[model samples]
Target: MPIVYSEKEASLQEVVTIQEVDDLLEWLLANTDASIDLAECRHLHLAALQTLASARRKVSAWPQDEAFKGWIKPLLTTGE
Candidate 1:
């Protein structure tokens, strides 16, 4: 399972399947100001990426792995 929706106060970890993207998006919409930590994430499908890109919420951090860090570089730089 992928660590999809995460915040300082709340967290949602589940398989990064197509069906879970909607729930993740909804969670992000509801907690726009929350600081999300995506350090433990494994894989994110295109659906999840789309939802994340469209979301108005702010993520605090990305995974420490170089590949993951590079992938989410734009998001990490854009402050909330």
Candidate 2:
């Protein structure tokens, strides 16, 4: 799985596809206090990006890919 969820965090690895968005949202809905770790994320589906933006959780770590991280970090981190 691209996203690994524990009690209070989601670790995003490699690529997070559109198919993972639903489960990702479900997990977010279930755990409003959860933080996200995107240190390993290379890419994220548009839907997944939107879902994460809407969820607006704390980002524990940004992506290792500088360009990717620069693009989405604001969208994900602005409100926090």
Candidate 3:
């Protein structure tokens, strides 16, 4: 399942699987007020992360897992 983060009455869904990224991206483009939250997820495929990173989307929080954090660190804190 994807992780969704809401801030300031806006919500963003972050997809970590290749299968769902496309759909999520479509949704995101249509709705720019939402925010993505990847901090609670685990086992996100690299390709999915890459797509979000390339788009420069910012995540609301960091995952608690160190490995997961390391993997997504670049994408999250880059202010993207």
Best by lDDT: 2
Give candidate 1 misplaced runs (Cα > 4 Å). Answer: 4-15, 75-80
What order do you get sorting by lDDT, best first?
2, 1, 3
| Worst lDDT 10-window in candidate 3 | 5-14
lDDT string, candidate 1, 1-80, tens digits: 45434454334342366877767776777777765566666556778767776664456556667786688657545554
lDDT of 3 at 7: 37
Report the backbone clash tally of model 1.
Answer: 0
lDDT minimum window of 10 residues, candidate 2: 71-80
For candidate 3, give the lDDT: 0.60
Q: Write the per-residue lDDT of candidate 2 for residues 1-80, one digit (tens) a residue.
A: 79999989999999999989989999999999989999999999999999999888899999998999899988998564
- Model 1 TM-score is 0.67
Best TM-score among the predictions, by candidate number: 2
Candidate 2 achieves a global lDDT of 0.93
Q: Against the hidden reference, what TM-scores do the models get?
A: 0.67, 0.95, 0.68
Clashing residue pairs in candidate 1, if any? none
| Residue pairs of candidate 3 with colliding backbone atoms | 57-80, 58-80
